[model samples]
Target: MGAWGISTFDNDDAADWLADLSDHQSLALVRETIAAALDADDYLEAPEASTALAACELIAAAIGRPSAAARKQETLTRWIAHRKPSPDTALIADALRAIDRVLGPESELRELWEETEDYAAWQADVVQLRSRLSH
Candidate 1:
């Protein structure tokens, strides 16, 4: 609950923090964070990147814009190609992992993702984890 930008809180704290926020407050925070991420020279290295991307996806869903996920995925792919072997690789990987966690089963957004035929199949292409826990 220290900041809305990262998943730094424990499960209960995160739940309470989210539950306590009004929709307007959440949207404003997320939008401001996203603007910051977008303005940064390298979002892959920016501390706000993970939260910004996830927030963008969530905000997009809230407003009925389904293309946000696809846009973010495209951005991630470009970052992967450009940043591999650089120290920033881990940051991009972590951001993807965060996105994966946010889109877990129980989320209505997860259902939207599942309805897409090849979204899950493209995971390996997007991130290079030999196994779920290996990388």
Candidate 2:
């Protein structure tokens, strides 16, 4: 139910734990939940960390942390594939860019940003980026 250090997988237990606590406890649980949500094994349906992040947004009551833009990008990628992004995506993207200003840019954050949703798509992009960057 929990992977205390993984941000992308098995987050329900962490979210449940986080939801029961106060702001003080929330800070710590937020870290755990985010990590769990990032773990590669978190997805059983969508392959992306977005589902687990939905849990983070609900129970953690916060979205932008660490690499906020990248996180939002991850979520948006999922939404875009579904057809269209809601207005909320823009809100989250704005918040994430603000966080990025404080955190500096997290280049190569893709290492932690890939989703499990579709390996072919991800792999192609990775290859493209790698080719471009390596040149």
| lDDT of predicted model 2 | 0.33
Which predicted model would earn the best TM-score? 1
How well does each candidate superpose onto the true structure, as a TM-score?
A: 0.31, 0.24
Off by over 4 Å in 1: 1-26, 65-135
lDDT of each: 0.37, 0.33
lDDT string, candidate 2, 1-135, tens digits: 333223322345423443343333223433443344344342322322333343333321232222232244343333333433222443344323322221222222233234344435543533332232222
